[model samples]
Target: MSSIKVECVVKAHNEIGEGPVWEEKDATLLYVDIYGPSISRWNSLTKETERMSTETYVGCVVPRSSGGYVIGEGTRFAAVDWEKRSITTITHVDTEKSNTRFNDGKVDPAGRFFAGTMAVEVRPTELERKQGSLYALQPDHSVVKHLDQVDLSNGLDWSPDHHIFYYIDSLKYMVEAFDYDLQTGGISNRRMVYRLKEDEGIPDGMCIDAEGKLWVACYNGGRVICIDPQTGTRLQTVQLPVAKITSCCFGGKNYSDLYITSATKGMDEEALAKQPEAGSIFKVTGLGVKGIPSYSFSG
Candidate 1:
């Protein structure tokens, strides 16, 4: 095992901090507070954070090749004008239902945006299962439903070669791989790559490293685990300061540092007291690995 070092860079008490995209040119990290309904940019060097309310629970945010950002705003794919603090709805999806909302999303190597929905209401041990679906926003601003009957779409990433797509349906307790087509932005040949035991926690957001291993954040497990997708074996473990570690991505100038996000959602006073950094942003350094850059939406 390699020596891992962790630090708390920003004390953002977000309700449900989820999607994190690192912009190299600006030397900043952009992430969404799913329930804060906001998008935030944190400077890596200065540690300064700027947040803008999306007005609706934002599932994720990614830099748009056309400028600004493309956000999963509730049930819609919208364009976010950072400078104007304005949002323009590009299209609405899942218009037939209100029980689900957009959850996690990412851009493909071809510059297509993909996001999935999850049950809107959560009970102690149950949620409206299979009320969600996965969507793709093409470069032309058209919406397409690629997968349906999804319980909780969380993590989604592709292999370094862009041939295998990895995905997580939180309720399923496993990581799934699919044969991917870079040109068509399509996936098939679904298979399980990793499965977590009951005590290991739920898999949440994910990203790939240069070596093609998976760095997965465990929501209730409080750890970011590195897994060899080919063998379904655990290669490394990064224990965070708090449980409910929601998502993670690679950043830093060299793309070696790992930035993690957490959530305080559904935690009672007692639970909250046990982990005061429940909603803070964290960083892991000296992992001795580099990560691929986050793709931007072409449109």
Candidate 2:
């Protein structure tokens, strides 16, 4: 197969575009504009875009089996009813810290919603530095803090076999793996899977293709790289016009099209001039890798 060629599929005027999830049922791409505090939907067939306003900065969004979406706002988890245009706060996270907010998150194969938190505004104390945590929310609305003491929790995914979980702390520029027990929600045997060199950009979001290869977004590298999870071998790289590529996922009817999200919030004038399409969504076809379908919240 040829190296993927990425092209802008949608030109979004978002200040920060982060999460991109493709809904197979509706043939639409759903993503959040974190700074915009809005959920945007794009119809791949009709090329129409729709926006829904929210009360907080939305970090990520996933489909719910019951006809709505489960989303992570700054420090809260909520369910949005698209039909009624209503939002119900299901759970509030990190309320005591005041400096932390929810970041990247995804659902496991067993239907549990997992999300991580990050410092919204840095403070000068140890408590403020250790405030971020990873949470697992059960269907009954109960939430559990599974892990803590993270700087910038982002980029979460699972291996195709459901036995390995991949996570990233962007500031550390490393991707870590944990042995995952699908039946018990137990994660152990944590170890570094891939550590980015100083020359490379920080690792942001990631996704696993059908073959179980990991596709990780390079925040300041202006590219997405495919890597062998077990061997840590770089397989391929798809260049983008923006330096802050945030996340990516395989979508489209066949799941062979790769969709990428980017950010423009931190760019200086010089960087912005070089990357005019900083916050736009790009698509790469002929990748030949399909991602696992996103699991919805069962409740």
* RMSD values, in order shown: 1.2, 2.4
lDDT of each: 0.91, 0.84
For 52-112, candidate 1 gives per-residue lDDT tens digits of 9987889999999879999998899999999999999999999999877899999999999
Best by lDDT: 1
Q: Candidate 1: global Cα-lDDT?
A: 0.91
Q: TM-score for candidate 1, please give it.
A: 0.97
For each candidate, how many residue pairs have backbone atoms clashing (under 3 Å)? 0, 0
Q: What is the Å distance of residue 27 in model 2 from its true position?
A: 1.1
* Candidate 2 lDDT over residue span 212-295, tens digit each: 899999987888999898898888888888887889988997788899998887667887788778889999987878777888
Q: Say which candidate scores most in TM-score.
A: 1
